[model samples]
Target: MLGIKVELIDKIGMHSSDTAMIFLEDVKVPASHIIGEEGMGFTYQMLQFQEERLWAGAAAVVPFYKIIRDTAEYCGQRKAFGQPVLSNQSVYFRLAELATEVELLRSLLHKATAQYCMGHNVTKMASMVKLKAGRLAREIPDACLQYWGGMGFTSDVLVSRFYRDFRILSIGGGADEVMLSIIAKEMNILPSKKK
Candidate 1:
């Protein structure tokens, strides 16, 4: 495990300002808590972000897979017009397609994280993973909810909990827009762009 933990020092919109500060403050440690070299802290922190973001991206695939599978099961078990809802090709195929997308995104995130660990240029890869992960964070639950119809909206459903939990990925670690800015900066397309 890495020897660092990042806490957001700013929160606007949803949560309270004090909540953000509380996260920022965390708990102070003794001076001995420092590890390795003092000057290397930024580098270590950046690397930690890479690993953390990659894990956050890759982790989405499992619950996404389960959501699609369980939605399929629900559709299959529920009867419509004396036949199962899964009988409809549109519904089942779309669920399968989303599953395939989750797999592809997982692969991309893993490969990018590997490149990052190797000390290669990985800003584009990282941004791509972050962007895709955020999109999937929204897409997976929305799709699952659609499949469940009214039942998905209720708090009792397992899918509802996933819907709420996965939402933090985009804005929590770093907003999707923030990742885009990082990618743009790395690509020399922002202020650094030739004018």
Candidate 2:
């Protein structure tokens, strides 16, 4: 621990957050500090990741709903041409579609949570929720931001902040690809490895 060094890496978005690369040199961790069994660290970490992905999926639902609701409100007040932007069929319809998607994700999250509470394995469901959450986090903001027009592109607005922050949902808590792989394995659809 004495020789360990941490360096921060500047990222394109999430400017308000911290991302650091830690370099461990001659680091020795005591047996007491090890989580769970000595040789079971990877298993423990995977179990922890299941909880993390579930939490990430559940947490994303509210913000997505808020973004859509807020954007809809903004559109109602902000006029384009001779009428409010929300009055346009395309705008309202798109909002409806996004809202439905958000609701679906929310339902999936709840189902997974209930299963987990009943002491059942939620691995497959959690992976699905994580995948959906990540996709929605990307899709919802992008769609809503369009109605914000120029303001959404600027850094001053909340929508812009959401646009930046939500991008990490797909990459963090197990990436979309990783989640897909997990789901595929759970479904027994992945091709078996050749020895």
Candidate 3:
């Protein structure tokens, strides 16, 4: 820990998670602390990314279910034109679609997890799950936020908080575009590199 300084980066969204900027000044490590081979740090970190992506996908699951449930409950109570907002066909239909997307994502996460547990390589499926999760995390919150209308724009509401927090799902842990590229490469569709 000597000569290592850590500072929090203040930015919009996911404030509590606290992205840190580490400054290493004349840092030295004992040979005993080296992980795997001396030159394989990048490879080791790359290997660890699979698990991080899966976690990002899995972490969004329960929160999504909760958000969907809370949004539905709010819609059921908030009225417009003398009837519950949820009573409107479009609102109900969109909620149903969002909920179904969440379920589909959950299934993919489970399948990837099972394969990972069985020691099978799940790169493709995990990337797919992460990609879908990132997209749904953005879409579901935005849609639900609209139902809350003015209240959704306020920082106090869960929908708004999620709208901010979940934005990182698509941006962090490899990003949606990076995930797509990974999937394409895994599928053997990427063009061969020229030497």
Candidates 2 and 3, the one with greater lDDT: 3
Model 3 residue 171 lDDT?
79
Ranking by TM-score: 2, 3, 1
Q: Considering only N, C-alpha and C atoms within 3 Å, which residue pairs clash in candidate 3?
A: none
Better of 1 and 3 by TM-score: 3
lDDT of 3 by residue, 1-195 (tens): 789999989878888777899999999889999878999988998898879889988999998988888989999999999999999999989989998999999999999999999999999998998899899989989999999989999988888888888998887878898999889999889888899
lDDT of candidate 1 at residue 59, scale 0 to 100: 76
Question: What are the Cα lDDT values of the candidates?
Answer: 0.79, 0.89, 0.90
Where does candidate 1 stray beyond 4 Å?
Answer: 1-20, 23-30, 34-44, 191-195
Score candidate 3 by lDDT: 0.90
lDDT of 1 by residue, 58-138 (tens): 778788888889999999988788998889999889888889889989889879978987888776787778788888888
lDDT tens readout by residue for model 2, 169-188: 89987899999999999999
Better of 1 and 2 by lDDT: 2
